[model samples]
Target: MSKDNAPATLPPVKRRNAELVMLGVALAVTVSAFGASGLALDGSLPVGMFGYGIGFIAITIGTHVALRFIAPYADPLILPLAVFLTGLGLAMVWRLNQGDGDHAGAGMQLIWAAVGMLLCLGVLFFLKEPRVLQRYPYLFALAAIVLMMLPILPVIGIERFGARRWIGFGGFTLQPSEFAKIALVLFLSAYLVLKRDVLSLASRQIKVFGFRVFDVPRLRDMAPMVVAWMLAIMLLVVSTDLGTSLLMFGTFLAMIYVATQRSSWVIIGVSMFLGGATIAYFLFSHVQLRVMIWLNTFDPEIADNEGWQLVQGLYAMAEGGLLGTGLGAGRPDQNFAADSDLILVSFGEELGLAGLMVIVMAIFLLVERGLRVALASREMFVKLLATGLSFIFAFQVFVVLGGVTRLIPLTGMTTPLMSAGGSSIMASWIMIGLLLRLSDNARKPAPQAIQDEGATQVISR
Candidate 1:
């Protein structure tokens, strides 16, 4: 074809390049944080700087390279944002562990991060299409159930702090609920995609506050949402994990809203959760203590036991003020779950409000990009999956940070990528993998479609 007759197409996006550059910056910041910690704590270079830097750069750069090959058109912001959070978390964990006279926690976190990245790579390698998961919604749902149930078993269920939320085998304890969340999202997305029409159109019409609201779903239509609610409630009852329950239910409700374009589902979901939580608070001592502690954190009676963690966190945040205390100089060890639940408060104490805001903004960007991917996708299944996964981050962050800041009752939810749990890290990276794949499908150019002898053949380059 002549130059004038030749096809014209825009150049492919430089998303991978952008990710690489941002990853570099994130790594540098992590190293700088370590340096600052060392200088403040012992007046020398931080311990294990070279080893940590090498491991971080290796895993992150390798992950970026994998993305270039598998999801070249994926959103640029997700990878770097994840690395940034992980790096910051590692820094915080390392600094906090310095007071322990052992390098175990930070070292374990690094190992977990590596394992998580490997899982992410495995996802990219195996899951050719995110929509493929829609074919087995029931399977995913069952897996989620089993995962939730595992921690309640008598033999392997390991109890800690009055809750059996972990299962220990072969000396490595695992929190199954963290990974169950992905399966739950998958099942919910697939279920909603198939039922969106019925849920949105087949419901009884209801008007409230003089405005037409959602149509009440049929008993059959309501079954799925009911099951989801029951499962969340069951999880709360069995594990006494209010945070996971809220996160799961909230994600399900958000996906329902997106799928059906109905706000009533969200209202109903939130109200139901609040009612259940109120009931639990009155009936369960642990639940009641969390609420009481949240309400009266400074009470001299329980302040030494249930409220001590939060009070110390508040004191640390106050000490840091708006600018933080420089990485290694603060005492996050005074708070319980300093490396997981209260990590944000720890960061706030040392990095100050400014650094905390930076972290929050980074998280906001990651969530925004996930939502954007959902909007960009054409398939209902893919859209709902992205939305559900994205909302997990939004809800989890709010739950953890709000608890730490005393805005809400403390629950045992860990910040994604910024927490010390292996399951949380792996689950988060898996979510990133799905997001990257979905974003790739969203932004990648369509293949050529050809027609020959009543058959159309398409080829992807």
Candidate 2:
């Protein structure tokens, strides 16, 4: 056939090149943000750009190159999106440390980023197939529970910010809740896949108003959700990590809905949560304080301490307006936990409303892509796992941003890749690797094996 008359059908191409270009852009944005911070603060570039730039670029490029070789068919956008968010976070962390000294410096964050990438690489390398995870769901469930409870242990557990949510050794402290989230996602995915049929079966159909809207499930089927519900509430009470609890439970609820294809499961889950929250609100002083602060943050009495951080976040965001103070010129430190919980506010103040919208949209894209992978997967376990990971990721971002903007009670979760905590960054990266692995399986073409050989061998035998 002539070149012009050639068939339009062509083999699908791997988008590794597209990913490489986007990675370059991401690295540029990150380095530029850091440089801009220096200019805004001292009217000059940093003295150690050579070392910092080399470290940052090297880690990013190395991770990307390994991903291209290992999982070339994986969704191209996810890795780049993660890189951009991580870089932007490191830049902001660096920006915040400029005047306050390098106690929580970008140097340390770069090291953590390297560690996160390395761990992420390890997941991609060793976890060759996600289906293997489905085989040992109960094992992960125990690990998850133990990890969540570790933070409350007296010896190693360290209480900070009135919450017993960290375990430390010497100078190092880790949040087990971060790793627990991974286990929760895996457990819910595997368990739901195995028992979805029973869970979907209705013990009785109840008429609501004009339609039969509710499914009264057998108590046996209900036991799983009941256990999950109690565990969520227990974590909330013990670790005081309400955000993690909410994220974990919400993901489970979402996975149940996906597995059963039932809206009723969602209804039941929400009702159970609301009822538990109502009880907690009255019984727990911290919960009451959180609710009160959410309702009336600007009030004089509450603004001094309890609501002070939130109010400062609101003011900083407002001050940023649309264009922001141009990177480092704005003071993000005014808000407490500026590099972690209220990191969104830091982006808003320095990057502006437009910038914040871009960030939120990027997060939305990442979650959307994950959902796409879930929809495309052939295996039920893979679908549920991807769905759980995606939703929890999205819920964390929404709750944190919503809390900052007074849209909901502040459930202090780190803002995914944008947050400064080592535990959070590592966990987020590992989840990203899992998502990438899932996507690669979804996109990669299955080999067509010869069936004739088997038949001939059998006949000959």
TM-score of 2: 0.94
Residue range 1-461, candidate 1, lDDT tens digits: 69997658553464677678889899999889888888888999975987887898899999998888877888898899999999999988888888777688888999999999888888878987888889999999999999999998999998787567899999999999889999999998998878888888655678888777766666777787778888888877778887888888888888899988887777777877788777877887778777889999998987788788878888988988999987888887777778888889898888899999999999989999999999989998998998999999999999988887888887788899998989899899999888988988888766532132114223331
lDDT (10s digit) by residue, model 2, range 1-461:
69998757553346999999999999999889878988998999977655777898999999989998888889999999999999999889888877678645788888988999998889889988999999999998999989988988889998888678789998998988889989988988889888988888988888968699777777778787888789888877776667877887888888899999887788888889888888888888888887899999989999987899988999999999998989989999767889999989999998899999999999989999999999989999999999988997899997898889888888768988889989999999999999999998888765542254456569999
Highest lDDT scorer: 2
In Å, residue 266's CA in model 1 sits off its true spot by 1.4
lDDT of 2 at 322: 96
Q: Could you tell me which residue pairs clash in candidate 1? A: 204-216, 324-352
lDDT of 1 at 229: 80
| Poorest stretch of ten by lDDT in candidate 2 | 447-456
